[model samples]
Target: MTRLIKYAFLMSAAIALTACNETLEDIAPKAERQLPSRVVQTMKAKGMSKTSPVMMRIFKEEGKLEVWKAKQNGRYDVIASYDICKWSGQLGPKFTEGDRQAPEGFYTVRPGQMNPKSSYYLAFNIGFPNAYDQANGRTGKHLMVHGACSSAGCYSMTDEQISEIYAFARDSFKGGQREFQVQAFPFRMTAENMARYRNDPNYDFWKMLKVGYDHFELTKVPPKVDVCGKRYVFNSEPANGGKFSPAASCPPMSQPESLLTAYKQHQAKYDFAFNAALKKQSSSKQSETIAGHSEARLVADWSKRRARGEKVSRLPPNIPSPTAVAEAPEAAPTPAVAATASAYTAEPASRLQTALEAVAGEQQEETTTAATETPAAGTVPSPAPRPNTSPERTASVPAPEAGSQGTSLRRRIQNLFSR
Candidate 1:
């Protein structure tokens, strides 16, 4: 009976082992499976590896780069966020080349900026003096990010560290996202950062760039840089290869026609509104003097126009002579009986009339109030005088004139309105 029981136990154990192998088949790795061809094509276009979708982010100041993807509910599930084994310089806007400062702007990674054989693990350069930079007279070059724990102005990730970042970028870019923007800010572009170094030596330049940078952070697209001179000029459109493309080196020449086109369009809208309002005002009366009733009516009409977002082409053509609106006249009850007329003194009735007339020009009120407000920071108020109606000033805000290679904002506005 004992021998039979031992034989029975051994058979039962063998049967249990075979059943476990079948149940674990789903967890086993597939050695022969391959990625679909469509995925392969996309990976090639975005310069990604064949294994996964690219999804990554980098914060240079914090020395962290992360990879993540969305969960079923659309929240990000981080695959990784790691500390840099090596990095260089404090975070700030790199102005001149070789300032040993990491740039604070939007950038991307390209195959060219990347070096597979870089002594560090992998590497790429943050190309500065981009088209936008050149238009603003920003000069800089050769800002790089690399691997193997080494840095000058570049970010160095260990070979293993960057592999994850590279994989994420490659996969994300390949997944139908044309361009991924990398925002590198000085620690953070917080109110604290601005206050801490409001008087730093580089404050002015940083502040100026901050305007454009903030706009980009908010809008994701670059702000229109308005360089003013005889002719307003602008930088070229951002190139596709992040910071390191040859496209950065050969910024497209500014085409006056294109810029003028945009200006003309904006102007046409303004002109239409101005003409309509002027016609309405003219129809009120042909008299040189305006009445109090007419003044109140005009203000109501202007309020309506403002509600609709219409800009006045010009300030109510400076009242050649200003006037005040007439006040309600008081009257006494009819005289009960005819009384002897009393002698009346004839004071300077004309002077009183002149003063009363000055009160009737309602349009002047808005102009007077606007004049008293403080000018925006960094802007010098233009001398008070007849509003500048010069065709150039009236047509568009004047900006720096572009050389053969630069485009001017003024030109764009002109072109837009002219059309």
Candidate 2:
């Protein structure tokens, strides 16, 4: 009976051990459910589609939008290009939201403005007049990319194309921009990116802005913006479509300064450059001519160009090589003095004379010291000084003024006393 009890205990202990092992196994991820361990596996899961993604590229130079078909692993082929808006006002930063002006900063394309059947034609909301604007105390609303060649302050793509673009963005968002990069730039920020402008009474504000622009320039990521004291702290976090909120400390936009002012400032420069280019083109027959001058001749030339189907643009000439540019020859180094010159020989003799003089002076000083030590000529030595001759204390003496005789007298006295 005791043996039977022992066997039963052994069996119970074995079963408990097995149960613990099974519990651990259950907690571990199953081999089938594990995330793919390789990039290829992830790629396979995210299937590639042949259908081109709709993309919009805004050219600030022409104030137009270039609709593109961004095929996977393919170049962005232009479907159509259309002038959407003109520079409405000044070129300054949008200080507050709801300024009724389009923003120049890089913003992500998001959902919320995809409408197929709208009265003003097909449109997509730019998600503008955003919270930043409202927080900054800006007013205005309903900024959309709509149809009709008119705008209060919105990009108006053609009615037919906007629908296609909208559909494409919707689908692509569902897909991804790794297949496309739909981007928009403002008033050709390229050259204007360099053009000069005065510190908009809000120079400091723009400096803060430059922080955000610099980040975007480097990372190509829209900066996470934070606002304090009506100034922007760009790249503060919430740097993309994520579950992040603007900081609670963000102050309200009491600044009456128009965000459009930044645009207006920027526009002046762009308009200047653009108009200058236009004027140059109009005035100069030096512009490239394909065997024609008159408007009729140009039209005929254009028709010939169309027949040949050659693309034409008034692009600037290629920059010249460094070698092509003339540079002044470097001046020869000032001629070095010849070692055989008398100046060099005299230099050593003078140095030797100085050394000999120094030695002679030292000898003379020694002789004078000896003379003082031995006692003045013809003077008898005083009776042998007392053995314990301690000097009497004197009242404190002020230091001698700089370069005073007191200093020289002190040195002479010290020498005599030493002697």
Candidate 3:
């Protein structure tokens, strides 16, 4: 009787364990179908397997998304480029929850962040309001690079395109790439491009982003990014061998000497070309002034109208259909051009541009604000203090001052003018 009782207990425990395992499996997202043949072929051509680690770079102005795969040689190569079907807001970093601006910054994606069973076909969170965004008191949620080819404040790709992109990320994760970097930029960080927009209010911010951009360009490896003094600092180890603190003053640091030398040389060449480009552009056209109510003011006005029960006349911008996009030849990878002057591509005539024009026509009395204003030199303010006891930090950092909350919102709106 004792032997029989022991056998029954062991059998019951085994059944319970099996049931628990099954329950876990049931909750997991279903395995996706095999990668498309084209994607497979492209991976092979680029000397990458399905499991190769990847990095992505997005350019808002160019409407392009580039997938770079790590090669056997330990360098990343551009494996594919897809046109962004749609993106919202303008060419600037997103600040507020309802602003409808897709973000522009460095982000990371981990395996658990993937949503294989997504309403938008498939999706991956872009991990917005990152350390830098949080330190600056930016706010938003559910910012994603996803399928559906439509967006309110996300990077939208065609369903087909996203499937391929998603598969690359999924396989990379499976191959033990714990996280991959996503670098989103307002525009290609080229010397000529920078020179053309040098007077834009966001020029300083773009210059800062260019530092990371240059790092990748020189080494074909994503720079290790950290934040300090409320700005991004890349690819250096703290002199005292301590962990970097985003809101703290950056300690003395050093980078590999060869990498530093290469970067300096690249910058020298870029500066020479930038000067020539600036001179040529200045001679050719008077600076083209953007004549319109900035997107922020229009959004604010739209909100007011809605609250008052007025019918809004305009609709959100429409994205091009997949068929329409397929007919156009793929945009060639932008080549590094010499210092000789070349004309920048004119901004496309899209619904967003038309809306800006309409708003300008109506709000002629509105004061024009620069895209974003630069803080006075040598005025790096310390971040507001917070309790260090919490293991899980809050997404929203405390405002520097009670009154500064309003000031921060105004700055965000002003920054939208650059878009």
Candidate 4:
């Protein structure tokens, strides 16, 4: 009886831990463990090993997550590009807990970070709040690139995507790779994008990130990341042979002169392109502003035409001037009010009497037409525009005044033509 009890206890423990790892029937590990045929074929074609080291890069604005694998030459090549299903927050780094921000920086992912039986299908923490983030006093936790297409301060992907990505990491580990790198950015660090975003509040931080970006572009290898004096310094080691401290002053360091020379050449070309991009953008904004003002002026004329029940522009214009409706031969309330007023204000006293007569005729015509109309069922007819009474202001067809009266008159007389 004592021996049986011990066997039962051991069996219970196995069942309890089953979900954390594979079951007995899962020993083959082919479908779940091996890379897919296409990917394997790609590896062979690219001269990469079956289980080489992997690196990942993310672009939040572009919603792309790229997996890169090391080739035999110690350089990296693109293996896969997955579309991120969701990532929260704007184009900036996380500031505190619950900011819902997917962080941006260089991060390391060790073996312990992988989660196979995740509630989100599978996941791995991207290791946010790295040395630089810490030195700057940023805070957050459990930022992951996970499946289930759900994101809350995490980078999320579909279940299928995470499965493949997880396979890459797993196989790399099986081949004795210890850790991988993740470089996250707001967008592709292009010269044009840099020029466009030069004035953003986060530009200084992004400039720091570009050092690593430039390194990879030059060498096709992930840069060695270290933080010192609250900044990221790539591929440089302290001459004094001390470990880097996130918050301490950087020691004297040695750097590769060849890499520096390549970077300088790259920067010079980038500078030229960036300046050209800025000029193009500046010119674009000026043209839009000019067009916007012209469009604004079109609205006034369009409103005027609608009030008088005349056909105007189908849309606002690049220029505002006398509308076709204003020049149309006839509408109940003709633009004669504006025209007559303009003529009277400029001509002699004899013309004032004639202009007043034209204005009176126009007002009478509008009033008579409105009074004769019948409103639809379940509706009362609009009250007719009042008849001209005072000679000093015989009729006031509100000419774009600023109050509610202006609002009522400037808006179109709906269904006026059908009436």
Best model number under lDDT: 4
Cα error, candidate 2, residue 112 (Å): 2.7
Ten residues in sequence with the least summed lDDT for candidate 4? 410-419
Which is the leading candidate under TM-score? 4
Query: Which runs in model 3 stand beyond 4 Å of their true positions?
Result: 1-31, 286-419
What TM-score would you give candidate 4 relative to the actual structure?
A: 0.67
Candidate 4, residues 46-126, lDDT tens digits: the string is 988878999999999999999999999999999999999999998988889898988999999998998876889889998
List lDDT for all candidates, in order. Answer: 0.48, 0.45, 0.74, 0.77
lDDT of 3: 0.74
Quote the lDDT for 78 in model 3: 94
lDDT (0-100) at residue 387 of candidate 2?
39
| Residue 376 lDDT (model 3) | 64
Give me the overall lDDT of model 2: 0.45
Count clashes in each candidate, considering only residues at least 3 apart in sequence or on different chains.
56, 17, 1, 0
What does the lDDT read for residue 17 in candidate 1? 65
Q: Rank all candidate structures by their lDDT, best first, as comma-separated numbers.
A: 4, 3, 1, 2
When 2 and 3 are scored with lDDT, the better candidate is: 3
lDDT of 1: 0.48
Give per-model CA RMSD. Answer: 25.1, 31.0, 27.2, 14.4
Off by over 4 Å in 2: 1-62, 66-82, 85-87, 93-100, 103-109, 176-186, 190-194, 199-213, 220-419
